[model samples]
Target: MRNERKFYIDGQWVDPLKPNDLEVINPATEKPIGVIAMGTAADIDRAVAAAKRAFATYSQTSVEERLALLEKLLEIYKRRYEEMARTITAELGAPITMSTEQQADVGVGHLQGFIDALKRLKTREVLPNGDVVRREPIGVCGLITPWNWPINQIVLKVVPALATGSTCVLKPSEFTPLNAILYAEMVHEAGFPAGTFNLVNGDGLECGAALSRHRYVDMMSFTGSTRAGIAVSKDAAETVKRVTLELGGKSPNVVFADSDLEEGVADGVAQCFNNSGQSCDAPTRMLVERSAYDKALEIAERAGRQAEVGNPEEEGTHIGPLVSHIQFGRVQALIEAGVAEGARLLVGGPGKPEGFETGYFAKPTIFADVNNDMRIAREEVFGPVLSIIPFDTEEQAIAIANDTAYGLAAYVQTGDPDRADRVASRLRAGMVHINGAPHRYGSPFGGYKQSGNGREGGIFGLEDFLEIKTVHHPARM
Candidate 1:
């Protein structure tokens, strides 16, 4: 069935001024699934104008009212959870299993988390100066989400903006626009005020740049590559808008000799290959102690081989196709470069897995004997590719881990608690997982350096949507 092709603006689904339509492809099948009206600068201006208008009233909403709205959104979001999962699997090429568990589930989780956080949030606090310090909404926000974790990035930015009473204009990745459309439907059904949430489906150059450069947008929360994030920042700088970016990463998974080698290697491989290794925080770079380098490489190869590569809908399919033909080409070229650079290809080479004729599926690749200087080691290869680099001492491992321009996440596996603590302290990333630690949903998630600024999740996320105001009052005497 042909889905809605209009943009969601001013609480209504409206057609764009131009009939410039973009075909939405099902990456797994390499077929045209649907089409959406590609929004232009004029459309963005209309959406932003609506948001600015809505913010006049929405920003004045009390914390209790905003919390109620978030709770209602959570309920509505849960009703369509399965549909969102299916859309992600079809549009973004995420395995069906991952779409259900991590992709779609993260959207619902973020909404619920925002609801819970808003309930406990103290918008008005008494200061020592006897004046009330109020945290208010920061007006209209511009959210540009990536294709990797479509709904996850959207809700992470959307829920918080809503909870803080900031109206938003969302520009989801043109590559994976289906889930964003579904989300707009949900938002409409949930009965949000006109212009409280807007969705404009278009490419970065047209719709995204318009939102960034728009003067009415008070803040911009973008999740994508570091290169694109830099452009968004530069565009938004014209108005000096607040910009929150969750960019690329080449995070290191340090495997110490004193740790559980088998378990560590297994978890590291899973983390790197999960979501087809499109995660901004995927531990793609593996740094093993020189003493256990050979063992780590063997285990990593075995783990890579074990990852089932097939259709995303098939049961037990651990890995799926790359999101697009371009991504597949990029990954193949990088894999070829890794081989040319002398990084030994332990398992996979530069091509689709055997028997996969259609789709953008790639074999789970592992490159051992990798030095820190290789392209695969330095760059963010957003595919199922792992690089195993050997480190002689603890100091060398730390130095290698901190060499990347992106510092989003780091993984350190060590049996010794003291050693783990020491290593974690030295890492440059925003979050460090020790001994295969799992991420807490409520904890703040973000990055350091070029990995982008500000934080998401927990209270930190709420802070990004709020503006602090100090009320000057004479001391009560």
Candidate 2:
């Protein structure tokens, strides 16, 4: 019965100019949990105007002042930590352990990472010829984030924009707007100048499109599907503003025969099944060498069985329902396509995980003997779906991994250090993981190719919100 019908504008929770009632459903129980007032173009116009006004003063703030503001935000975020965890679990259906640990924790991690990175940044530097180069905040940023990792995406965009002294107006996914609302509360409490941060809640067609196409929006940071990213880019092109997109991936996890069989295969499976396989960088495709393909299949099946799909609030539950019925149907269709196209279904299939009936639950499915051309292998089926393809040699493995339209991420598992380096260098992706290595904290993250443009995370994320200005004057003594 929670009803949040206001948009945060000019540092206040104000009602939308005109509201459309939209329901937010809990995926785990297939129940309507809350309602929100979806914003219209008028709301976007108001928020963008507020942000543009604030940018005049906020963008000129000293780095030290911006750093102070970040410290306050981090402090306030920690105090409201449990609320963050609960909001994500309620809206996202992330298992309690994961919601509290990984999903919620990533927001804090990015906040802290930006604070640390900002401390080391040199805002101004002198060239050998005594010309001064300055990094300046790109005015108002319109941030459109997805539902899968709400807080992570929100913080990645907002913190950097704040740290670099850029005012922002955010349009979080209509499916998961609770956490974003909570975040706006935190920003207000932190006492940022009026209009430093504004939030407009609505779908891509209304609020998102309005913000992206706004002429006053100096930059756009979008995290979502490839189709939507392309749409945002097209809209932003009218203004010729800088746009950063973190889109889809059918990323490959290549496992060499010389690697540890049980560890590599099990880890690959776990990575694929993590977050119910909704992650953009999830290793959905595992390319195993011919000598270890069968063994990898056995280990992958075992790992999939080990992942218990049940209540998201339960203590040890590892998998939950897809975000909505639409997502559930999408995943189901891909599974059916794999069957018709003749990819060997190893475990689990198109139906909900056993013991559940009404929820948008999906069985953790795995397909072996898959070719790179298969629909399941080529498309980003964002579900608990894994495709295992076998390769005969190192060259073949690289060729297979690099053949996708996505270049968001890739993985490699090998015993030989030199071979690992060689394979990594040949892969066409923004981020590459070696032997299931954890994600790098401050490393630049984004894609090449059709995956999207620009980077986010650490110093790179800050730079994305900044513009370079060269001052050519008298040499400094």
Candidate 3:
């Protein structure tokens, strides 16, 4: 087992003041792969102090200087790209194929996106009224990321903070600290100034709360459950720090009768089951047009049942397992609720897939005849579970899609161009994918409602870490 009990603080790896070591488990093997020091409030304090001190100089860096560092970091990331993929596969139980294609790719893709965004950004702009609007770095940032898309969330928050000349302390999920540690090494090798970036490993209560509530921290960027996001917002409120969140979602995928039912439904199922359906914007709820709902159901059932499950060490397109037993239990209970609540268990049901008894692998599941109010349709089951609901009319489809508390992402499937545009406008989501269009890098990724506020990615992402100041010149001479 690897020993990674040291926290990255002040540009060096230091022992945690209180060595509450935690075993990092591999969900695929149900065994400890490594150990990490669970950070305490004091650890957070030390990191915050370092960040506070570093912000003085680091926050003054020119955009060109920051871009050079980012480019260097990207270069290092490319050199170690395969290692990142393998590490994600080993630690998060993502299949090697998926890890290499999606999970680890985000580290490079988002970095490049930020590099482009930074190049286009203007630090100062003069308004018609002769007022100079300056965008300056916010002070010390408290960044908390989730485990599902480990490097994705890290780059989304950390890169922007550093790109905009802000210093930050990161508290990645305790479940997946290894990747964050590896990323810290990359940042260090990129030659960023000491204390500009720090990492402390701990749970949400101790290390996370301390970082959120610290008076010296000027902003908090968190990506996790809505419950935890609310807690972070409340904690940051104590010090009146700016808080941005990317929280939970039960996004809807509306399949109209006009679209190719077979292709659209099958593709939707694959997208939902990708990452074992742990993605925040996964189309968990599928709303089918009633006229073609039966055909869509048949396609969805086959798609779900055909989703392959395999070991993380394998190099195929199969999904591996959940990150932990806790996540497994949550997904299982939600699946059980679907059966108990009268939703048809159309495909794979609760329990590990056959031959996967040792690990925390959940069978890819699909539920048909589900209502909008059903637990399967309402909750964000971070597993390979998809819920299908049928609707009678265009208005009803839009209503059902928009009824959810989450507005992170919504999908529209229709051959009619006008209808696609109309429904896309009506749906309440930050991002709407029409006919399986993928979300590219550099576009804003966020949601409208309880899915959380503020966007991440590209220029919008950089804005989150910056403070806008308008300097007014004296009356014209």
Maximum-lDDT candidate: 3
Q: Could you tell me the C-alpha RMSD of candidate 2 in Å?
A: 1.0
Q: Write one digit per residue (lDDT tens) for candidate 1, span 271-364.
A: 8989888888999999999999999988988888898887887656478889999999999999999999999989888988888879999888
Better of 1 and 2 by lDDT: 2
- What's the lDDT for all of these models? 0.90, 0.92, 0.94
Task: Report the C-alpha lDDT of model 2 over 17-93, residue by residue, as the tens digit.
Answer: 77588989999988888999999989999999999999999988998998888889889999999889988988988
Candidates sorted by TM-score, best first? 3, 2, 1
Local accuracy of candidate 3 as per-residue lDDT tens digits, 256-342:
999998889999999999988899999999999999988898888788778899988988878889999999999999999999999
List of clashing residue pairs for candidate 3: none
User: What is the alpha-carbon lDDT of model 2 when measured against the actual structure?
Assistant: 0.92
Span of 10 residues, lowest total lDDT, candidate 2? 468-477
Candidate 3's displacement at residue 404, Å, is: 1.1
TM-score of 1: 0.98
Model 3 CA RMSD to the hidden true structure, in angstroms: 0.8
Ranking by lDDT: 3, 2, 1
- RMSD of each predicted structure: 1.1, 1.0, 0.8
TM-score of each: 0.98, 0.99, 0.99
